[model samples]
Target chain A: MEGCTIIEFILLVIAYFIGLILLGIYAHKRTKKTAQDYFLANRTFGPVILFFTLAATNFSAFTFLGFAGKAYDSGFGQYGIMAFGTAIMAVMFYVIGRKVWKLGKEKGYITPPELIGDRFNSTSLRLLFMGVMVVFTIPYLATQAIGAGMLIESVTGASIGWQIGAIFTMFVIMIYVIFGGMRGSGWTDVIQGVLMISALTLAVVFIAINLGGFEAANTMAYNASPELFTRPGGGDFFMPMMWFSFMLLWIFADPMFPQIFSRFYTAKDEKSLKQSMILYPIVVSFLFLCPVLIGIWAHGVGLDVSGQKDMVLPMMVANYAPGFVYAFVMVGALAALMSTADSQLLSLSTMLSHDLPFKKRKISEINIGRMLIVILSLFAILFVITSYNPREGIMGTLVKTTFSGLAVLCPTTIAALYWKRATKYGCIASILIGETSVFIFQYNILPTFGLLSAIWAIIIAIIVLIVVSYLTKAK
Target chain B: GLWWRQSEPLMFGLPFWVVYLLILTLITSVAFYLFSKYYW
Candidate 1:
């Protein structure tokens, strides 16, 4: 909280940005002029880069800020829901990702829509997939900007507003992604992923020691809010049905994320993808515990994060850790969001350029993709600055909008991959009907039967896909 | 749900369910490793 410490934090952040720009320049030099090279890094990612990029891309503001905030509001059940659910998702990385990788490498597919469209031989389905991904991903991208804005506002003690922080975060991400493309983002992800894990581990250690170590901290938290230690935690948020719903949701939704989906194509071989899958659960199991523990400990230590639970991690760090630790942790937090936003912008841009039926021109697709990154980033920044409300909290916003909407695509995707009988009509109906149901359920227009809207949406989409596929198969 | 709802018998300062979940994650990781080595 010292002015000097704030100065140190600003300096460190500037230096970090410089390092990223340098990496971007290096990647730009390595990048070939082809669309595949820019968008998919020429399918040359080794195991290590693939693992880190996948990890860093997936663990966004959602993991760093949103997880802690949800833990603060709900309880430790957050850990069980996230860790176990995501671990289970690693199975899909093989079941789904392996196939996607094989197909992409075989067919030279660049984007998720291209793969799906080629399989079904339907341009309409491809456009629908692209449309859904773009619509859903933008909100998730906004969450990263929102997290950056909140972190800056909290770390600077309001000398800097959230709008400035959000814009600055988007601007830096755009520069690197435009320069380096996937290779740039992938390499930066390696550094950012390391920083993110190291900072969280260090922050947790410092906070635990400050609270008289892990046992004492846990005891204090339990005494302060015993409900957090149980399922259907603090606010009765994680009921049995809801818990089941969440676990199921991650399996379907996570693989469908355009950023994550496109990553399947970037791996050098099946071995790299397999290694990433195996490492994912082990890494997630440890990394997630840090923020959840910090959130619970903040409550135990009585940090008064009521209504603004998303700030719990930052508030705790600023109050408990030394200025150096605080500064490093904030940088790590920035790394988390930036790593994700860059990937999201790049993936979305790739889809827009490659999948959409734009008129042919002299401009190469890679250049068009670069221009789209800036445009998409501007839209995300606008969303954060004008539309985002910190009070709604990141977790709730993501679950309601992005997570549920994307999750609905799972059935269609699965059928597309696994079921030979799946027709274009079935895929189209599944997506349209499923997404509509998600919208309806999210708005409470229909009942969710004590489950998340995503669960119902997935179910409906699967049935529609099967029935429609059968009915249309004779044609 | 009933078992996890109980808060007694903390392990390493974590609630019983939290430890249980961590153990489950480890088991899942082991499963993934096995799959990666032998099956994948």
Candidate 2:
């Protein structure tokens, strides 16, 4: 990129951060000085804000950049997997989200593990859940930093290296969370969500027009590689068993994600949650599928994205888009990264400061929550600096592993709400065995049965929960 | 079964998966609307 173009992109990014900080300060001024208000936005999110925040928090730049690259390399089957998987997740929101939201409001819960521990009446189980969450969440958090760095560098053509970009990204999110907490995060998410959806829609439409519309572009892609448009898809991306495992992972494990689960507590009413669910599949599909289409278009036009798959979308925008459009899309991509990072940082801090068995005699819970946000951001920045050079499909690998690990908690979460017979021992045993089995299956230490590790872990978890709960009833 | 493997007869210049997913999005949202109204 030329120096002028690089300057334009940098200025655009700075402008976006300025907008976010102002929103953060506004939220901070409006929020009450209480733990519930700081962490849960006093449970006052309406349907529209609830919908955008949840959708934006669920996806990261990883959805657009990483999914596009994966689809470009693996074929449209990956897109199908993501689109359908997300829709299934929305369905779960109707059943699980309502139950969780009602309990959260009645009991004044701050986090999911807090509800789980209180329901089972076990501090140890809560601590165990927090530990599992922190471990899995780190990589997912690091991906945001990595993605921000890659996006900035690609758009500016290495005028800004990914490391500095990552650092700046970390700083922006931390500042917002420190200032606004959940309210700030929610406000910023609404803006980012709208910007991202618009950018993706516009990017696809522009790319299609450039490549002679969707019909011609689809024809070109089909002629080049027909398998990409088919069921099994090119590159043998969709194996039957693995696809089944992925579907199961999305349906069961996604709601258990800390950031997503927090939205259940943040929603104001049942109708709001329901309205968010009703609108989610429609918005989410377009937000995700547009990038996949752009990726296919790039491939059809014969852009080589090998060895650096995750940067394909950025590369396409840099090459084909006008300077103004390039800067706007870059802002959108960074918005996606920051939206998720802010929520994850807050969720991690909440777990460490509140959900875990930590005494707050010396310091207030909200202050400790603020301190942990800085700590986690610094920790993630260090992880990003060390593990900067990830290989192809790194995004896909990190995301899948995180989901599988979180899936270990799926049975426990559901049972805590539904099964009165569930015991503390069963919950703890389920978590330990489920988490360990997920790692084992992840590394192929155990037989996978050609399924995802999460599937196996969940199977083991339910058995352990049942047998152990039966063997040792709750006193 | 080749039920999912049918990619030749394209719909609206898109292939099977693209059309199927687009249609699936509409179906899912409508289903969610009804489920939320009555069942949920």
Candidate 3:
């Protein structure tokens, strides 16, 4: 916002990049031998690092940036819906995570789709899900990269080219993820997790001090716009949208997110998996509250900068915070964005290379994974450039809607894991319906409903799976 | 009509704030031992 602030931000950006480059080099040398070392961190990470890894997979830039914007503009209801989807998923981790962990250990599984395909006897199902995941996630990835660049701008100044910043940071993420693998990602997540909290805590503290405290923040916000705190559906419709989006897209629909699944086979026992599950949702709940609170603070302060929404947190830090504190905020935002991006690039790459049918032995998987990393990187960069204006982009909208559509897979996936009777046809039917729903919704051909898309999709999927499984006798 | 702070606490006591720090310390110590014995 000022000349001196811009100078401080640029210096902070330099220091943060230097730190990450060194960390990448350090990880590359530390773990190099087996793919297990690369992908699963040798299955030896303690509950702590493992805790953050599971949590990191959830705290994307969207949480830090987009949701903060949402919180700033709307109110707390959206945050509550996020909690609901997360709580249900956490229970899955406690109940289903252990099962997946056990099965992974027994079978030497690498991805969620591997388990899904094996259990249900459906190869096409695995590939189809993986394809949707990669395509849908690229926009999600672009969101991360763009958010990171925006963070750079918020701290340093708008003079820094977003495309330039995004590409450079993305390349750094690829190097660490490609070379060091999950260990790199997991360790980085631990550091990034700390930075994310520190940045959030710093911002929250500064804002609260300025506004006096949470009570004062609430009072001031009410003074500005009573609707900010109390409105139907929590003053904004975004929360219900997220509940459907997160559950269907993340929980039930996309069964195999490679990062989380990669950890499943690596976790030592059922106890570790259960503990990690319980710990993760709670940690995420805490991390999410920081931004949401900051959003409330922003409303109270009455700062109405327009067009760029996600930049609220960083810009607020720049405005209210001292120069050195602003530096910390800059690095913290970097931690949040890259933590999510590194895993995304790695997982997307792995899905393409190892999961897709390459023309050779399964052991030949290593090389394909790296090559796919480069392609995914290129594809993501192109998509970001095309997006030009993220708010109007078809990609993000498609991803948001499609996630709800995937709700069709929820019942089928959960049933497949436990119910031995879950036939291949059941899984197939769910996938077909889910994919079709996403396409239909993306085109806006259907009317809006009260329930989330994922909920409706899952409801339909379960009914079909039950009826179809019943009609088709077991072999 | 409804109370809000109830959702944000731990064991309804002072421990909620310190829980993650404790877990982090415990997990790190155990991990260090496991890694040194097996992978390192």
Candidate 4:
């Protein structure tokens, strides 16, 4: 609504894009015309860079928009679930990342599907994983696009609709990622990570100063809605079993996400992976905290956040924040979204170009990877422009659906890595059972069996994997 | 029920749950550091 604020924000966004193009050119010079250079960045990332890229990729718009909005709508319990789940998931990385790194190095694996397919000696199963990666990743990618669009619309008003903003985001991401490859994405992630944190820190400081101090802000929020400071009432908030399921959701499925699992392949050494895992939860918890504080601030200011939950942060900043502060924060949100969307598209491109059955013998791997990135980026842009819905909060119903779908693949990965008895037939059975059960439970076609759909899916998958492995063992 | 799960006993002028989350995060970082040092 304010002229100066909108002008300053637009200028910052333009500056950010210019920065990304420069980074893309730098990455392009180093990028060789090979799969390893394009997809895994030649396995060159150390612990610190790995940590930043992973943290940036992991948080996404979901952290700032969806999760923060959830906190505003629900309560502080959203933070507890995410912070604790992430800690536990970090431990999973410790257990899994080292093994994956070693295997990737030894066998020259780039995607999770490639690793699993070779391990099980089954191409069909690998394709299944690739299918899951492409199908489920679209919404997550679209979420980022939708988030960027919403941020633009919130700041710029109806002059530029959110759909056009989303299209512009997709176009920008396609350029850097198609030219720069993984190195471009990884280096850009470092910048994006810093922007993401700075945005949150500035917003937090701005809100705190406006409300007198952090304590006063908390008091004001409590006065405005004491139940928002508590648990389990306002809107199906934090039921015990449901909370347990939400916690399990990320711990089990996040490591299987193509974008994250591929990072395990890029670690320079075992120690780098180990150290990153050790530091990950700490960094992410801090990142996660910033948005929750903003959410609480929104509530304290008495915004109608529940009705327009995703708009909480942007609306607050646009209405009340200092112009430059809002500019930096919006760019941070844009950087966060692009960082995530690029990573996911890169992973999807790797799967399509390298893992799929269709083989083109003549084309260079880098070209194919770049081509796939363009196609997938266009697909995502189309999805966002035609069907993008902001009503689906960042961490809300849609992400849960995606996570639940992805969780089915986790048992197959764990069993393939750890259990000698895990067979091709077993993995196939388990993946089908796990994925199908999520749909069944999610749509309430079957009883939930006293737990969430994801939990039920995991239970069913583990059982089916073991049973089929034993029964179908080689004679 | 866990004591920190309650809303009472606001620590440092914040809710018990919020303080509990910070403690949980600290414990997690420390535990992870130890794990990396010894086991990993």
Considering every candidate listed, which one attains the maximal DockQ?
1
Per-residue lDDT tens digits of candidate 1, residues A201-237?
Answer: 9999989989999999999999999998888888889
Candidate 1 retains true contacts at a fraction of: 0.76
Worst 10 residues of 1 chain A by lDDT: A1-10
Best by lDDT: 1
* Residue A358 lDDT (model 4): 67
In order, what DockQ does each candidate have?
0.74, 0.66, 0.05, 0.57
lDDT of 4 by residue, A11-122 (tens): 7788899889889889999988778988999999998889888888888887878777887888778787888788778887766788888899999999999988998899
- Under CAPRI classification, how is model 4 graded? medium
Can you give the lDDT of residue A197 in candidate 2? 87
Candidate 1, which CAPRI tier?
A: medium
lDDT of 3 by residue, A353-407 (tens): 6567767565546567777777787777886677546554222453465455444
True contacts kept of each: 0.76, 0.73, 0.00, 0.53
Pick the winner on TM-score between candidates 1 and 2.
1
Cα TM-score of candidate 2: 0.97
Residue pairs in candidate 1 whose N, alpha carbon or C atoms collide under 3 angstroms = none
Let me know the DockQ for model 1.
Answer: 0.74
| Rank by lDDT (best first) | 1, 2, 4, 3
How do the residues A361-394 of candidate 2 rate in per-residue lDDT, one tens digit apiece? 6988899999999999999999888864545465
lDDT, residue A91, model 3:
49
| Single-chain TM-score of chain A, each candidate | 0.98, 0.97, 0.90, 0.97
**Superior by TM-score: candidate 1 or candidate 4:** 1
